[model samples]
Target: MTIQVDENEQEPWTVLRISGELDLVTSPLIRRRVHAAVAGGRHDVVLDLSAVRFCDSSGVGVLVAARRLMRSCGGRLRLILPARGAEDGAHVNRVLAALGVRRLFEVYEDVPAALDERTAPLSA
Candidate 1:
């Protein structure tokens, strides 16, 4: 399946809403987009993975790399991973958890909460 990534600005953060399968073939697209955003000076980023249906190790790697990149640049990275059963939940979330890397990211239930500076990440 084809992966679609839509980018938008939410004031202090740039949100990237990704949907479809996240595997070896499509993961590079995400990495490139994140890199481009960083290259363009956008540090605070929110990855909206609520719509994602599947995620593989490559996708997880990309996410970890993104987090690392943001930190290296002194920026922040957040993830939107809706709780299970909430509109199909977040497949990427499950993958990250299974891989034991979910705690590395600040995860929120939605974009609004992720963008809110006063909000806190959900437990991993």
Candidate 2:
């Protein structure tokens, strides 16, 4: 299935809300969006993957690359992945956890939390 990525802003953070299957064909789209964000001098980014139904290795790779890119530019990258409820609340969350990379990111349960500078990330 095709993926949908919606870009928006939450103050200092650029929120990228992604939905649908994240596979080889669609992962590049996310990667490009991230690059654009970084190139535009917007360092802080929030990747909201709560709506993502499926996530593959390529998707994981893109997330990792995005994280790396933000770090290289002295920017911060945060993720939104609900830790409880059905299916771990997000497939991407489970995928990242299963892959042992979930702990590498600062993850929030929702957009508000992600955007809030005072809030701490959920435990991995």
Candidate 3:
């Protein structure tokens, strides 16, 4: 499946809402978006992965790379991943955990939660 990233802005945070499958063929597109966000002077961003139905290892790589890129730029990145639901709840979460790198990111159940500065990032 093809991956589509839609940019949704809410002041200090720029949300990249992702959908469809994120695999080898489509992961680069996301990598570019993350780069572009940093290039455009955005240091705070959210990756809304709640709508993504599938995520392969390549996708995981892109996420890890994004975290690195943002950190290199002194940026903050948040991810929206719904908790334990029958649909669209935990695919990315499981992948990140399985790879033993989930702790490197800040994950939230929704956009509002992720965007809240008062809320501490989830334990890695």
The candidate maximizing TM-score is 1
lDDT of 3 by residue, 9-119 (tens): 897999999998889999989999999989999989899999888888999999999999989999998998766443774788878887898888898878888888888
lDDT of 1 at 119: 90
Q: Give the 10-residue window scoring lowest on summed lDDT in candidate 2.
A: 82-91
Off by over 4 Å in 1: none
Candidate 3 lands at a TM-score of 0.93
- Any residue pairs clashing in model 1, and if so which? none
Clash counts for all predictions: 0, 0, 1
C-alpha lDDT of residue 9 in model 2: 81
lDDT of 1: 0.90
lDDT of each: 0.90, 0.90, 0.87
Candidates 1 and 2 compared: the better one by lDDT is: 2
Task: Report RMSD for candidate 3.
Answer: 1.4
Instruction: Assess every candidate by TM-score.
Output: 0.95, 0.94, 0.93
Query: At residue 75, what lDDT does model 3 achieve?
Result: 93
